[model samples]
Target: MSHAHDHDPTVPREALIAIAAVLLAVMGLAGAVRLGIVPQSANPELSRAAANVAPAQQRNLRFADREDGAVLVTDADTGETVKVIGFGEGGFARATMRRMAKRRMHEGIGPLPPFTLTRWQNGALSLSDPQTGETAEIHGFGADHSATFAEMLEGARS
Candidate 1:
């Protein structure tokens, strides 16, 4: 004779309790931050600390993808093409611009306004979008990636 039984699969009581605890914790943290009980992060571009000092050099630039699959970096003030980074090269710069371009497209914004590239006295590099007020810290990515921007800065000065 075959025994007839129903097998019910369910989460353990411990798991349910743990999940509830985590959910509550997340809600509490969100509430605290929203209420300003937790301080917001400082803007690195404005910070005057030793590691994040004022910009030693700054340039306003715009980037566009060429029909040839290369990135064209242009000087915003002069309306001249500053540099043409090959399709595969300057990957970090290309990616950064792509992210900003996506955001601009989503916001119904055009690419007329330029992005500011700053090299801080403390050796920090940043890319800032004036239209969006968004800033990206370039140095955090590594020397190789940062050099791509650094080279742009040098080219802009020339």
Candidate 2:
């Protein structure tokens, strides 16, 4: 006995054409933006809020993991323990540090130079690695996460 299908398994021709047209439009827009034919809008989430302003304060900080899973933020210049983030707290700070540390390890660079945390004149905070030239704008992470780094920055001298 042979069985007959109740419905066709193929997509409509119009659907395929629509999909291709949408894809081509997206590609063209991207190309135009990349070639500077179309201006790209600044993405607040991915951009530094205070890029044009001077930093009101900057701290060279070293992050160390304690045996019990806590993270210690120390002033690199003064060698002072600035903030001790208890285990389970400071999720953002810990995650950011881990990402930078992993990159350094992959590149075979030791943790001699510490990261710089800056509070801009506009009150935006940012963390930067001088060794790798990587920067994370703290303000982009939201107020709560930004506060974590802001507190650490407050502890260090100018």
Best by lDDT: 2
- lDDT agreement of model 2 with the native: 0.84
| CA RMSD of each candidate after superposition | 5.0, 5.1
For model 1, the run of ten residues with the poorest summed lDDT: 43-52
**Superposed Cα deviation of residue 51, candidate 1 (Å):** 8.5
Q: Candidate 1: global Cα-lDDT?
A: 0.83
lDDT string, candidate 1, 14-95, tens digits: 9999999999999998888888997546646446563546678888998888898999988898888778999888888889
lDDT of each: 0.83, 0.84
lDDT of 2 by residue, 58-115 (tens): 8999988899999888899998899999999888889999899888888888877899
Each prediction's TM-score versus the true structure: 0.72, 0.74
Query: Where does the lowest 10-residue lDDT sum fall in candidate 2?
Result: 43-52
The residue pairs in collision within model 2 are: none
Quote the lDDT for 93 in model 1: 81
